[model samples]
Target: MRLRVEFTTEPFDLDEAPAHAVVAREVIQSADLDAVDVGPFGNTAEGHADAVLAAVDALLRDSLGAGATRISLQVNVVAEGHK
Candidate 1:
């Protein structure tokens, strides 16, 4: 199975996002999973469900360690369809 995920962390300041966001972004990008897109509001990646879930877990831990009081995440399971 494949997945798409969006992540947001707070204390959220639209103008200047917290350091935890940056750390979380790096964690996701560094994962060996497929990278579709990434941005301040959210990110999108596709790969094995296990790998994606692992990456998400790691990201969460790192973000919290970096001082993220709260996080918002949206995950979607995508079917392999012709693009």
Candidate 2:
């Protein structure tokens, strides 16, 4: 199965990206995933279940350790023929 993960690490920083946000982006960008989209307000990645899950695990751990006060996330199963 394939999975899509969408997330944001916060205490938003308008002047610069926070450490937690930077960590979160690093986790996703380096994971064994595809279709990654990292943005100021949110981020998203798509890949096989294992890859997505592993990325999620690291994203949570690293981002929180870097001091994110909150994380908003969602995961969904991609339909068979969908992106």
Candidate 3:
């Protein structure tokens, strides 16, 4: 199934936000999931959702450790057998 994961947070400056973006991409990659794209929105990331919940959990832990104030994530997955 295909999924889309979006992450938003505060304390992600333009310069430092890239670091967080990289972290997110790495998480998805580590999970053996395809990262369609990854970028920052003030302090948010919007793109492929290969690992869904697992990726989100890891992202939260990693991002928070990186000094993020607030982190919000949304995952949309395509159900099986639904084409």
Cα lDDT listed for each candidate:
0.81, 0.96, 0.59
Candidate 3: regions farther than 4 A off = 18-21, 42-50, 79-83
Candidate 3 local distance difference test against the native: 0.59
Best by lDDT: 2
Clashing pairs in 3: none
- Tell me how candidate 2 scores on lDDT: 0.96
1 or 2, greater by lDDT: 2
Clashing residue pairs, backbone N/CA/C < 3 A, model 2: none
Q: Of models 1 and 3, which has the larger TM-score?
A: 1
Q: Write the per-residue lDDT of candidate 3 for residues 1-83, one digit (tens) a residue.
A: 56656666665677655455567656755663443455566222233444566667897888677666777776777554432
Could you tell me the TM-score of candidate 3?
0.61
The ten-residue window of minimal lDDT in model 1 covers 74-83
> Compared with the true structure, what per-residue lDDT tens digits does model 1 show for residues 1-83?
77777777788778986899888888888887885577777767777788889988998999999999998888888787611
What is the per-residue lDDT of model 2 for residues 1-83, given as tens digits with 9 covering 90 to 100? 99999999999998999999999999999999999999999999999999999999999999999999999999999976666
TM-score of each: 0.84, 0.96, 0.61
Cα error, residue 50 of model 3, in Å, equals 8.5
**Model 3 residue 30 CA deviation in Å:** 3.1
